[model samples]
Target: MSVIQILIINAVLVSIAMVVLWLVSLRLKDASIVDIFWGLGFVLIAWMTMAVATQDLRSILLVAMTTIWGVRLAAYLAWRNHGKGEDSRYAAMRDHRGGSFWWVSLVTVFGLQGAVMWLISLPIQVGSCETVPMSLPNYAGLIVWAIGFLFESVGDFQLARFKSKAENNGKVMDRGLWRYTRHPNYFGNSLIWWGIFWVSASSSTLWLAISPILMTFLLLKVSGVALLEKSLANRSGEYRDYICRTSAFFPWPPARRHGSKLV
Candidate 1:
């Protein structure tokens, strides 16, 4: 199948899935469920592309990497959000929209996310069509992907452990991977997409670079850092301190404060 055909099919499939999920959310009255499915949506597109496109080593590798990342992310979100009622973001929207939130959420939440998912998964779709032999960039991309996976997984584990402690309540997390960056998970996620794009890089596929760039833009400016920091900005002085010392999106050595040495 042609790349365009694969992308169209993936879009349709994702749209259908999102509509069904929206219906389920209406039944449960929880639009937050969309967050849990966000990762899995990419996995679905990866596998679907692999099934229809060329089944070479590169395609298989893309599918594997996507599956590992997507499944882990979905599982993590499911666990973290378990028993937590609708996320505050969605709850506020629901309250503001009042009785019309059911239909409004279908367009704003599910449709928007589904569209983004399809766009971000462009590399996987296009790369799966590549039957050419893997080159240097492909191997390098794998290494980058491994590093990102480590950061994302370890950072999440550390944060989860910290949050699980009762004494840590209202405390800013400035240790572990969080010490280097205010948002290790978001940084890692951006790297993961960039790695995917690198693996798929080719003269013909160069235009698809937008896939990774969009992901990075979303992480740094849109939903990830910007939105989260806005909420954290008013939380505590410690968070403000953490922000001052730590990099916002990239991993870097923390800046030292008066009377405190960098750890």
Candidate 2:
């Protein structure tokens, strides 16, 4: 199939999936379920693109990388968010919108996310249709992907474990990967897409660089680092100190205060 046809089909599929998920959220009265669906949405688009396009090694690799990232992300969010009720962001929106939140969420939350997902999956859609053999750039991209996966997965695990301990409650998470970067998971997430873009880059597909750029921008300035940090900004002085010392979106050694105390 042509790349345009593949994108059109994926767009339709994503819209349908979002609508169904929106309906389910209405039944559950929890728009936060969309968070779990976020990763899976990309997985769905990747696999569907591979199915309709050339099923070569590059496409298979892309699909596999996406699946690994998406499934792990979905599972982690599911586990962490279980019994947590709606996320505060959606709850606040619900309160602000009153009764209209149900339908508002359908358009603003589900539909918007679906559109972003489709746009971000452009690389997968185009790469799957390219019919190219695995090359050095592909292998290098895989390595980059592996590093991102490790950081995201391990950072999440560490945070979850830390949060599970009652003693750590209300404390800044400045340990493990969190020490080097305030948001290892977000950093890793941006890297994942950059790696995917690298794998997908070609003479024709280079235009799709916007996909990863958008993803990184979202992770840094939109939903990931900026949003989360804003919420944590007033939580404690320690978080402010953490921000002063740790890298925001990159891994670096923790900064130290006078007397050799790690900030």
Task: Write candidate 1's Cα lDDT for 49-156 as tens digits.
Answer: 998999988888899999999999999999999998999999999999999999999999999999999998989999889867889988899988888888899999
- Per-model TM-score, in order, reads 0.97, 0.97
In Å, residue 6's CA in model 2 sits off its true spot by: 0.4
Model 2 misplacement above 4 A: 259-263
Judged by lDDT against the true structure, how good is candidate 1? 0.91
Candidate 2 structure quality by residue, lDDT tens digits, 114-134:
999999988898888776666
